[model samples]
Target: MTSNSPDRPATAHPGTPVRGRAHPPRHRQGPSPEEGELLRPLTRRQIADRMGELGELYTRTTPSGRRKPPSGRPFSSDPSALLAPSPQARSAAFLRRLAEHMRRPGFELLVAEATRPSGATVLTACAYGFPVLGDDTWWQELDGHLPANLPDLAAPGGLFVIGDILVERRVRTQDQSRDWNLARRLQKRLLSDHTAAVGVTLVDRGDTDTVAALLSWGWRCLPSADRRLLVLR
Candidate 1:
């Protein structure tokens, strides 16, 4: 289903067709949220198909998607930063990642997708988010990655956790005048910082675009794991 949202300026990328600016800014409505997960790991082809849909969507929505890496190959502006050599490689890598994370009992895949004018569904963004229902031992696996200062998200009563978020570059950077539009929509219905907190692993060179928004929107940040894991409560 489509989400009923305020009109958003239509954003076009390299491969997408552009209309005359003489016509006025077009309105692109935001998409509704989708909540589901791959119950198990996917085969290489299945992963490729899933990622191709997201790649096209990412490329179509963001202006930066127009800028290709030196290799002259296309890549999704986000998540591929997880260190795959190419978009195709990223698909296989993501399959492995989903396998590791989803196999755990509590994690879920949360995505928001919209339909393009051509009737194709584009994934606007995705987050590895869910309730923290596992035991304290879960922290043991992550202990080596952070410093001692991280907040305890697995406190007695588990909290809702947003492990990672990868948003389509265009939805985030499309309208600079309203940089937070996409962020606002996703967080509004999903977060209650008082009881829900998000944890993210940040390397020194990664995209920190959403960090400022997370903090400015009232999430208290606690740095840990040699400052690698940033927990927002």
Candidate 2:
């Protein structure tokens, strides 16, 4: 999955986080009272309700002048399910099903929410992660060849691949400060609460903003021509 730039990294290094093994699965328990008000976890239904916004968010990320995948979206199975459409119906549906098992190790999905002064609920952030072998890359085991020698996957962390942080287009321009603040809050809670050892992302050459953001969160980049793997403790 070639990552979208930061304007850019409102997501990753939530690396698509995991609740500490010390804590029970979130499905069985809730965050303690002290976690923070801004970082609240929502159920699958909660996220499904906002799938429309997610679809729009997918539209927003497309670089200007470039088409938004032939399906008018990315993440389409036609290309590859891992490269699924951003806000397509099927993508959201798949996400809904995945959300049920979100609290488990190996795979984790999160949809963080926050309320606005207007008493409206908003979808502030989302992230996805999964397990991978040492030689894994965005291309996976394509043709059974790695682009370069890569290190093993980190223990305790899932591969954070999708971190979507966006607000409504109408509010995005008028409330840039609020948007960033909310996104940052979501990212912080995600990183602090969960542990995604490494993030497997797809990107062109050079350490882009996505790489920098992961590094800031105690994640290191294992560079390869084939993909960008962000590792953590």
For this target, which candidate reaches the highest lDDT against the unseen true structure?
1
Tens digit per residue, CA lDDT, model 1, 1-233: 75445444367665775554354446774432322211222343454467665444434432222233444456666865535255554445555665565555555554566666797755666555555533545455455554433335455334555555555554454542342445444444345432454443342213345554455444544544433344544
| Alpha carbon lDDT of each predicted model | 0.47, 0.44
Q: What TM-score does candidate 2 get on C-alpha atoms?
A: 0.44
Clashing pairs in 1: 62-170, 146-225, 146-226, 147-224, 147-225, 147-226
Candidate 2: regions farther than 4 A off: 1-37, 61-63, 67-106, 112-114, 131-185, 197-200, 204-221
Give the per-residue Cα lDDT of candidate 2 at 104. 40
Residue 223 of candidate 2: its Cα lDDT? Answer: 51
Candidate 1 minimal-lDDT segment of 10 residues: 32-41
Residue 74 in candidate 2, Cα distance off native in Å:
23
Residue 193's C-alpha lDDT in candidate 1? 30
